[model samples]
Target: MSRQHLASALILLAISVALLGALQLALVLPGSDVPAVLALFTIAACVYAAAGIFAWWRRPTNAMGMLITLGGFALLIAGLGNATVAPLEIVGAVFSTAIFAVIVHLLLAFPSGRLDSPSAAATVIGGYVVALPLQLPFVFASADSREFAVASTTQRIAGAAIMISAAAILTNRLVRAQPRTRRILLPLYSYGVIAVLAVPATSLVFTTLGVRGGVAMPVIQLIVLTGVPLAFTAGVLSGSFARTGEIIQLSEWLGASDSRRGPLTAALAHTLGDSSVQLAFRLDKSDSYVDEHGTPVKLHSDTRHRGQVAITTNEREIAVIGYDTQLTARDEDVRRAGQVVAIAIDRTRLANELIAAQRDVVASRARLVDAADQERFRIAQNLHDGIQVQLVLLALEAQQLANASDTPRNVSTRATELRKRIDAAAGDLRRLVHDVVPLALLQRGLVAAVEDLVDRMPIPTDLVTEHENPALTSTVENTAYFVIAEALANTVKHSGATSASVRIDSNPERVFLEVKDNGRGGAVAGKRGLGGLADRVDALGGHFSIDSVPANGTRLIVELPCG
Candidate 1:
């Protein structure tokens, strides 16, 4: 057994010894009601002691366990009240009221052992003063002594004061506690209410009815005492199961594959049974916090409605979980769930980071493709407006010189050759302009432009359209056309291809294009024009890949989103 269990075993042995001593004292006492009085003390002592031991064994860390243990010890000390020895009787009388103080302490500090606030501390302090210091003066007084009246009056005043304080504290706690916390505290509150009423009721009974009241007082005390410990134990058991059950359910929920349906805050709220729960992740680099979507969120104290708990890993705070303020009464439950919450928050942060990275890559690629497109447009415009116009003027001037009647035969022949050369240069410029930004692609569509391109190939080529062309955005059409053009060019230049086939297939969601060459196959992805083609496709949220086998042929595929 552990040291805690050993200590509990030792305490149980001491209680048993004290119970035997109380039994012996009852046998020796002279009064007719001695057995009944001793029975009340013995039963209270046995029940509270057993309850304390059980609590201590079950939850060693909770202050409730030690507080309950102390209550039981106080009852054992109270059992010394009827000892035959005068000194022992005086000691017992001085301390017998201490058990009532302990009960008040236990009720105020249920679930958690520490007195959490100034008001709670003051209440416990007052109970101790009334139960111990105020009762000291009555310790040595005999029942018939002149001082007995003063002692009795002081006892009634102190008892009434302690009971009133306990009632106020219990009422304040219940009023402020949340639904879940109030449920856990219900049993203890019931015990407090009964104790609050029973203390004064017993006094009134003894004062008004005399002998009959004396006959009923022990029975009343026994019932109240027995009920208090039982209620406290019941509350402890219920709270433990409720907390454990929530943790188990949360574990199972998080373990499933489709756990990403809701945000981290919703999952935590459901797990903690607090619908108002909010999660904020700490950004260590910025010394700030953000919600799960990465929007900045400021945290502040609002104890009336919400409570905050920090979640940490590796000794550093990773996030904060804000829950219902009423849960502050059971702060330990929140603390225990912190590890699971931290893991979930960390996972969400990583997923958000991955999405952000992909977004950045797509945006960067789009900017690159836009720059390339602008450069192509500028070159095409210059060829058509400046160089082609100048070439045409040169061709017209040479033709006019060649046709002049006053020109010599040699000069006319030279001018005719110069005109032919100028016309040829103009034709080359026109072809370059067409290659830079194909007019057909902009005016007609992807299919017509690709078909026009394949007809001009140096080797035999086939263009097949699997579906009638649907209207598409300019980016999609331009990207698909360029991907096919680059792949066919690469096949002609590097693959030593004699023939090639281009296929276009389309659906509502996306368009698929495939280019295959019947040539010596040695194609690599992200090489030569393939890399530029891949970038263009990626800019339009498309996929590009190359498959090649040495003996077979190269196949380039592009998939572009159309809708």
Candidate 2:
């Protein structure tokens, strides 16, 4: 509880105690002449009842609060009619009993963490009913005399039992509930103390008054009789109005719009500080989930928007902001305060996806650039290693022939050797053009083109495929052709094994091609021709991975996204 609330409670307590004590004294000592004391008690009871009712009617406020105020009024009336033990005394007695019953109910209703659970609700109600009859005898002692006294004392015991149970329930439940405030306990304790004091005080006042004036004017009795009822009614009205303000705030934040709704919402937000609020946004009111914090959270799913809507109301009337957050905080004040500070958080998840795509695009372009340069270098090397050497040998042979005799057999032999050299050069040129852009890729589909590569491989090989594919885009077909060519070349040059296998597969989402060789499996990607081939595949946005373990043959798998 805040200091102000605590102070108010203490003040009320002191006043009630003092007034009851003074009335008791006035009854014992005849010359005290304290009519003002009686009036003060009446006023106190009235005010207390009003405050109690006001508190009770507040939204989320317990019914027990109303009962406490009512109980006080009962005591107030009973004390006022000490001399005339007529309707006032009887009514006062009934009020006092009601006060006890209501106080018990309120204390039980005091929200303890899990103690306010449905099961606990039942237990609390049941406990109150069972313990109530024990106090019955204390209300009406020995019907023969019809006198009020502590002759039974059962009411006190019952009250004590209720206090203990309420305390135990509150302690156990509040720990789990993690309530934000301890303000409620004040009222419970206050009503208990007042009720206890009033009972004994009333007994003493009436008993002594019977001995004087043949019937003493019951100053305390008069106050208790009138004050308690009036106070209770006022309190209920005020508390209800306060609660209405709160509910209006919730509705506004919820974003409800009715003729009266908007005003109520605005008023509530103003009353509660810093509230992030959603006004009248419909939610399923059923669907719930466990949040990241492991809290069992529920969301209103019935609405069109399934997510939570929150509002933050600031000190400024016009600047109410909204956001998403939890609503488990028990203090209405804190919830209002949170509204003021909460900010709109933007999640750019879509931007992150674009960044990833850009990275892939850049990486693919770089690989294509490198592959082009590498292919040019390979063609140059082939000329130097094969065709150019053959040309040189032919030149040397021609010179020797010229220096030898001009005979038919020697001339014919030289001419035949010259033809062989020319043929070799023509073959090299054709091979170079084919490597640049295989014509087979255009005339035949990917499978046919790949089969041509397998046919050329020197090693024993098996080709397994179930081909049901659309006519691939030119770029896709070219990429596939080169991949198979590179795999075949690698197997021939490096595997040094008896067998190899090539498999092609496709699905709606992607195309998959794998080449496996039973050779010394240490074939790493990006080594020799294989690296250039892998780069070619990358330019087409396909993934390339080579699993080449020490004793296991290499498996080169490429997965290309088609969709």
Candidate 3:
């Protein structure tokens, strides 16, 4: 228990002792009814005080504890009226009427310990004004042997009026409360209605019979006060059981492995018995909150609504749970439910990330296949447009040279030019074939093929390879070769580079390729031909990245899974 709760317990204990001492003094006084009335009041005060302590210990945040404790303390103050000493009687007479006001306040604020509505607050204020302040005149009049009849009559009328108004407000609240709240408060409301009616009924009975200080008065008051404490305890227990059941049901519903946010939100709403409950997840990357569908959500509060509670895990906020204003009284319950759902929210978020990664992989593979088909088409067109036309022209020139027999020397010179043309056509065909699939790559190995490519480049290029080159699958070798070729081509054409280097390293599990250049570099992975290269690497289940800054130079890295 906290120091606050311990202090409250001690205060209640002191009040109990004071009430007992006063009741003992009353029992010794010379009166036939003194002992019975004092005993009845003592029993009622003890019950209320004990109930209040229980509530305080169980739920310190609730105001119901303070209200109940105040009600019991007020009873103790009223008990001082039964003391044998003259000074005690005067002091008790001044404050005894205030007990009725405390009772009215307790009834209006049952369970929540708050006067939630304007009408309820007004009723409580009126009860205090009539019971405590207005009754002062009657207290002085009775003590001085002055005209007290009118004052006494006026106090009774005002007290009855306040009790009737409180009953009406409580009845309305009970009728309008949410179904779940109404169920938990039904017992307290029922007892409150009886207590309210008892006050007026006791007054009417005594006035009709013209009787005072009768045995029936204390008996009736005992029954009424006894019901108040019992009703409060019943309400507290019922609410506890209801919350436990809700938590259990929520756990069972969430047990199934569901990764979707919609079902989780629905289950939480149903368990909380609030249809308006909303769930928002925080996107850590974006520093914003989003709904289940990925749309951003804004949290706002107005007079009729409260703000949201941030649900956290490991001190990092992952989600927010929003509820209605009516449900604010049960904030403790809402927080408990939020803690339970935080874990599930984390799991669902991870599952969503995995699904998104899988979709990107599928899309990247499709693009890679499409790019390969396009490259093949371009190769076919290049052969038809460049090398095929040159070969046809070379054949025609040869035929013309053979047909011209009159000018033998001219024929020999023309034939010599035709021989040079044939040599150029053959070289063009060889380069095209190398571009498609290097013969050295298939026969000698990847390193030899890359060396051949470096020799053909227009600018200075270096080739570095690990001595132990583990044989990779054909697909991996082809992809790596093309990736290097594309990077070097981009460097020579776009990066105004003076020199470049290609490095290849391989182990049992993967092959690593790096291309670096001392060039004015601003390479972007998603632009130019690099995007296609990235897709091809992804298709081979590899990783590709580029680091390029203007005036600094560029570095392209590719890792292909060779195992």
Give me the candidate number with maximum TM-score. 1
Give the alpha carbon lDDT tens digit for every residue of 249-318 in model 3. Answer: 5676667655532477777775565667888877766566666555567765563676477888999888
* CA shift of 108, model 2, Å: 13
Pitting candidate 1 against candidate 3, the one with the higher TM-score is 1
TM-score of 2: 0.38
lDDT of each: 0.74, 0.52, 0.73
Give the per-residue lDDT digits (tens) of candidate 1, residues 42-90. Answer: 6677677667666655544345656766777676666666767677677
lDDT of 2 by residue, 89-123 (tens): 44444344444444445444442111335654654
Ranking by TM-score: 1, 3, 2
Best by lDDT: 1
Regions of candidate 1 where Cα sits further than 4 Å from its true position: 1-243, 252-339, 458-477, 493-499, 505-511, 525-527, 535-542, 560-563
